[model samples]
Target chain A: MRHFVFSLFTLLLACGAQAELRVFATVPEWAALARELGGDRVKVYSATSAFQDPHRIEAKPSLLAQARQANLVVAAGAELEVGWLPLVLRDSGNAAIQPGRPGYFEAAACVDRLEVPSVVDRAHGDVHAAGNPHIHLDPHRVQKVAEALAARLAEVDAPNAATYQANLKAFSGKWQAAIARWEREGAPLKGVGVLVHHASFTYLTHWLGMKELGTLEPKPGIEPTSGQLSGLLARQQAAPARMVLRTAYNPEGPSQWIAGKSGTPAVLLPYTVGGTPAAKDLVGLFDDTLQRLLQAVR
Target chain B: MQKRIAMAAMLAATFGAQAADHSELAAIRAQIDDMKRAYEQRIAALEQKLAQAESRPAAKPAPATVQSERTDSRRPAAGPASGFNPEVSLILQGQYKNMKDVPERGITGFWPAGGHDHGEGAIEGISKRGFSVDHTELVLAANIDPYWRGQAIIAAIDGTAEVEEAWFQSLGLGHGIGLKGGRFRSGIGYLNEQHPHMWDFADAPLMYRALFGNHGSYTNDGVQLKWLAPTDTFIELGAEMGRGANFPGTDRNKNGSGAAAVFAHVGGEVGVSNSWRAGVSYLTTQAKSRAAHFAGTVDDEVEGLFDGRSQNFIADLVWKWAPNGNPKYQNFKFQTEYFQRREKGDLTCATPEGAAATVACDGMLSAYRTRQSGWYAQGVYQFTPNWRAGLRYEQLDSGRRDFGDNAAYLVVDSYRPKKASAMIDYSWSEFSRVRLQYAQDKSMFGITDNQVTVQYIMSLGAHGAHKF
Candidate 1:
């Protein structure tokens, strides 16, 4: 039948289109990094986005669909996506991207890691002591992820290895320059004190020699209760901490409460790109984040 | 750590006093013990790092300071279970309305055609209300270990507030067998097990609301068992004996009848492709009839015997398609479900024409039969991370019935009428929804009622399980 022939033709076209390597990333930052390295040859998507709280994303039907179609799945492992991604992948039956599979990419794997906690206690909050999952905020580590992704893309798409290599080189050069500029900008801010949620920005804070006073969350991923907030307020009133830092997605209520109870400014920073207009991309994300922190501290 | 150990000892003492009755909190403590072990391992790792750094040469003093600072950074604001998390969420929305026939309907008015009648005919003053807490709910969930998980839910509206789900789950059983018991939602169906906290819509679907009753067949006094098969598939079988719904103000010792229900469900998903499931359920009970005493506008109080039964079967399938790495956005998601039901027996008395009967069925008995089926297809597409749209079309029909073929019979008008309904809804974000839907219904059996409703939904809470 003519319909059957048309269907076969469409199927053939789809098969041909599938030649472009498919790569899945758990968040936009990693997806962006993969795209920069793989260029036109790889299709990338994130399990969560700049606007979403990576900690509490729901594994909905649509997300499962993406997991099903993925050829290579990337995520900020170390328990960042532990809440739902595991269920999604296990239910998706995507053996290709199952944990420990070659197609499975844990972006944190490449880092000379920090935040490797010696203790694992949930009494404070759910802990992913493997390492801090938020590493892309550090330019040097982000470059490492880019290099790994390029190598992986080359292995999957050998014909486009040269293109991926060139892309990685360009990305590294640009990243190196940006890091130098940030270092220079951060020269005078060493040991500057601040408070935040968990160790979400440990790499960035450590890079700038920012002395962390404490965290707003009594525990990782837990909200600041009234009693805890009051305690922090008491501490803030006494010590006059330079700044209170928070991600864009964190509830404004706790931050607002701390600000009202204590004469302190809560610096709402863009935790990822596209979270705010000022944080349009990786470079803009850091630039805007550092600028906001600098302004608050000053 | 000492405080925790003392508390654990005190809890163990309390549990020893009440040996038989399982204390949910005690089980949670055991689970926390496991998490404590994991935390201790991390602590050991950090201690080793610190020891190594401290033992290093004087030339590496800078590195040691950095290492100490990094260790300090890993510490959380909360000491242990203190001020660790405070969850909050917000939702605001509105409802637009247009009612046919009556310009105004109160909460107690008789329902127009194609609407569900709860305890009475639809009431008055219900149509014009703009927006309210349609889907706002709060959740605090914690897992102590493999054998215990604790959860609490609070809604903006409904009956007196009480703990909705408080139970302990056991996973260290034979062959992946798990046990659950306590005040929990009966795992009667795919949707029922998925608490209202997990629904995509502000209101449940019409078929579910109709047959199962609004609030969807929630009852107390139950136990459940789940078996995970080797192929990564799971089967759940459960039962419960609880107080039935009929006369609102009856005591458990009086005309209350024992109701028995049974159900089984199995399903799983593969890759990013699709998920499928099938289920069957049956429930039956005896009904007690009574005559009017103080309010004798009707017939004499008659003691009668009646049996009621209901059976349901369902098949469902879901498919999601998105290319790898792009999870923030999905091109499409598809879900479809088919359900069927059978019911028999009735308790109704004859009434004269042109006259409404407040009391008519004295020692009068009637028989009735019901056959129904329906299906629905729903999909959602995320245009961007902050925005998404959804569409759903649901259809249900209760076939025509036959009573005594006499006008005097109670439910005479509804003895042979069919009921059909359909709803379409769209939702935005994880917290809000706006819905518009229509239905056509006919049933004097008190089982047939229909009406159109424009509903709005809003939610506040930590993330709930997804519909995938």
Candidate 2:
């Protein structure tokens, strides 16, 4: 009888193995941020990996299935998935993580937005009309997102409230320190030359105080035509934007061509977390990207 | 001696039981009892010496039962705990097509060239050409939650439109019956219902072109009614209406109409495994076209247009024969669809044949009768998860089928109309497309022509629907 009771107790103990906090992130960097804030208490999952393009993802049945099961969802919002994500969430029918819910967190909302346009136009291809949505590159912005996320997580899991608060406190300190270092190191980038795809790098340029050199793509979503490339080539010959900045996911052909023709150095930045091997996580992304650019300029 | 040893064993057992309850106080008590017990021989010796020298009454000791009773109240209660959940996923879609002179055109205003006349006179050709945002779209979706979902879609003809999807759903609706109204595409037909990000071409099938006019898988206007049917296998039915936008010399027909469609689908494989769906739709418009004449440059030549009605029926069938029970055979699948449409009356015309040299002719009739149908058979073989090759053959015609044109526009046009087309295309994901198509077009006005179109499309997940 004693052995029987002991076995039942053991079964109950097995059933009580600690539950984990569910965290869903749009990119690897967001997932990494959640992990740093959550530590051992949370489990993180990312929708986009380093190898894929964040801008053109397909919402599949399997993805809806995933969204249906998430506890908290974090994304880079502001018209990024204007065409697709709405359909996915509508299809998933998951009520808890829907926008405006306690579990929903848009990274853009946590940061000070840049490149906000005065007008919205569709003639030049798909324009955010709102501005650039990628905010993970800015440490200050990421810290803000982390703080908001921590507060949200605490609302539901008050039992671990102190742990989450402590984690955020430590994370923000490290984040601010990194920002100060990067701002100083990236000082040389002020007034540096740059050519980019779309207005994707407007936030980065504004943050770094770089010169507004323009872009290689003719319009927001258009591929550069030969004429457009030639126009850019001519401009480069006269003014010479020294760095042709391309994200790892953006097509390299046009940037490479412009670089070859104009003799500008093409720098592939980790546009989002997991865009490069060195940027394996959120913090690692900003570190490696800043270090690479600083070294190149030096 | 045996009694003493038994008492010692009893003391050890009592202390062991105490350890099972309150260890903090029990540990201290156990140490005191053990020391007292250990020094019993010395205490007895000292007591005997004391008795020999002098005597005093021994102090009474407390009962052992009191210690045993205190163990029950000190056990720890279980800690309160909760839980968390995570969602993760990936979706990919790609296609290839053959475009041979199947000149993709837009839906123009009621042109006398495309419509037929049953006598009377002719309505002159009003419009030159049609335009459409037709292309093959590929969509890749990875969503983890309401706040974090990524969509990457690309298409050949129109390029790509990708966006971050983060919105709240199920805001209202307590009862089973409720609205799923939001910024979502309304349910239309078999192909339109499926994302182009998951399609088989850089262009839609020919039948889709014939029915929807210029807006393929037409979108706009919002709000939908979703009904949950009582069934074992997931069954849902929805209906929606949207405002159609127009461009150019045509009036901005913002007086949009309402469209309602019904779908019945069953999923779950059997035998060779098949997914079969059939849907019917009827779209009616109260929208009126701005009255105008076909003359190159006419002054105030306004005409009153008709309010029209179009109805469609579609049946789709997909058969899967997997290899070694592998489901990835979506890369190796055979599918086909047959679509039919019947359209009638949206305008009135003065029948010149019935008039005694004019001067007394009001509009003779208010409607036209037209029937059209088309079908296509397509097959796809996916070589890799990211790469797929597909082939499709489709034909469409606008003719006097079972229903002949009896309207004044057809009568005035003196129309003899027929159009035959064949389309083939190869697509690569949503980002690129190379299409070739050919069409033989003959109108009621004795104008015969052939058109061939070869086009290339590339997209950068900018803003586009998924390619199915």
Candidate 3:
């Protein structure tokens, strides 16, 4: 009889162990952020990897299954996942993670957005109509998002409120210190000129005060016409940028071609957490990015 | 005795002194207990204070979740989450076709596929020549309320218009239960639910055209209930009830219950790069005087009716591969579907004079019991972000039949029909594509045609992402 009671007690604990909150994030950056905020109290899954374009993510069954059981959903929003996220949420059959619920957290909503367009034109290749949604690259913005996510995790899984609070306290202390160090190291990038593959780095450029020398795409999502490529080539001959920036996810052919012909160095930034081997987490993401920019300068 | 009494008195005096030391030890023990009680009281008070502090957080009303959505200037001013602004999008589709001229053009032995006409794509014998606008689809979708979301699609084909799909589905059903109602595509086969524009090739597979009347699977007024099992592997089961007003159904122009279907699917990932899915489905329906027969093939063919009960069975499988689960640069998808249909009823036939039959008979009846089956397999590979190529092979068999002396009605080699097609396409973006395709079609017995099609699909406004 005693053995039976002990076995039943063990079973109860095993069931409780599987009760951790499930988090479904649209990008790896948000997944890393949730891991820091939720600690061991949650199991977080990212729909897209660091080496994939977030704007054109395909909806897979595994992703839908995650959404169906997710207690919280963190996304970049502002139409960053406008192509896929809505459908996934609708099909997930899980109402807890739907938009407008406390369980839904959009990172772009946590920060001051950049380049709010005065007009909307989808045909011109400016895909995101609600301004740019790639706001995760800015450390200050990421800190703000992390604070919101921590509070959301507490609200969604109230039983673990204390755990979330402790994790938040620890993360904020370390993240703030890291931010200050990054600002000091990135000081040299303040007026450095750069050409980009797309407008994906507007937040990075704004935060570091880097000069934007236009983009190789010419128009946002459209392939550059020969005329547009030649125009960029001719302009580069006159006033070349110090660095041509492209994320690991974006195709490298165009940026490398421009770099080769225009005599500029092309630098691949860790656009999100785990985009490169060195960027295994949120802090490493920024450290690697800043280090690359500084290296290009040297 | 007096001396002993004096010694006893002295012993008593010593015992009294030791008793005094024992009293001092008891007093020390009491003092220690009093200190422990005092410390316990202090700790309790501190714990109470800590609990109160934790219970009452700083009165900062958490950053209103509403403020996050309002920050985006793109949203309509002051219109929150449920503001009735539905997403609207327009699709423009056009195509050019070139095929060899033949004395007759028709898919030979498709019996019940002559009636329903719903979406895009050509049927067996209706292939056109030259340039034409195939279809322009208009789509509108939005969440109706917290519990429901609705979508409507209208297709404009040639000079006619049709509602391809219009349905409202439950949004709040958790644990994988889904409820959908209204006119929509039935999810019976792997490719049955996808629209023509989403197909890898410009033309429908020969098997699909023979079974679904050319535009892939036909849509119907219906309601569906689906459940996804709570397991690690992807398992789904669904049942649907629809008004059988179209081909193979012969709604008989009546409104009563006409058709019903049930399906089951299971899928799981093999590793980091490979994923696979397989499904089995069954559909049963009754057709009252269903209209059918070949039209203007070799001669003016006549229209006939098959009044009976029909049943169809479909088995399908799909396998996808992408290294490390990243398919942007390269991926391969192989899919195949096999279907068998059984019909039992009375079929009425006519003479070669067709609708103009004068003497040979206006009312010719034959006991009809027929079984037909077909299968198609296709593979698509995306070698680059913008370039892809696909190849497909299809075959159909006109199954065992007893026509009751109407041997003249049997057309072509009833046992076999085969077709092979290959295509390559380039996508400008996720929303736009141009494709070139060629095929050798022998759906008709002893007749072959080499066909070529150049097609383009362009989208404007909002387009939702496709599901895999």
* Best-fitting candidate, scored by TM-score: 3
> Candidate 2 i-RMS (Å)?
26.4
Per-model TM-score on C-alpha atoms: 0.50, 0.51, 0.85
* Model 3 Cα lDDT, one tens digit per residue, A1-298: 9999999999999988778998888999999999999887889888888877777666666677678778889888777887678878887777777776777777776664555443456666755544578888877778778777888888889988999989999999999898778888888888777988888888788678787787888678765556776787788767768988898877788878877887789899988898889999999999999999999999
For model 3 the local lDDT of residue A35 reads: 94
Better of 1 and 2 by DockQ: 1
**Alpha carbon lDDT of residue A20, candidate 2?**
71
Cα-lDDT of candidate 1: 0.56
What digit string (tens of lDDT, one per residue) describes model 1 on residues A71-163? 777787766876688656654545565554556777766654566654555444556655677878777778767877777777667788899
Better of 1 and 2 by lDDT: 1
TM-score of each model's B chain? 0.60, 0.49, 0.78
Q: How many pairs collide in each candidate, listed in order?
A: 53, 81, 0
Q: Model 2 compared with the native: what TM-score?
A: 0.51
Candidate DockQ values, in order, are: 0.05, 0.02, 0.12
Give one digit per residue, the lDDT tens place, for model 3 in B367-432. Answer: 878898999999999998788999999999887876654445434236588899999999987788
lDDT of 2 by residue, A103-166 (tens): 6666665543444443444454555643467656656556767887788778756788899999
Computed on C-alpha atoms, the DockQ of candidate 2 is: 0.02
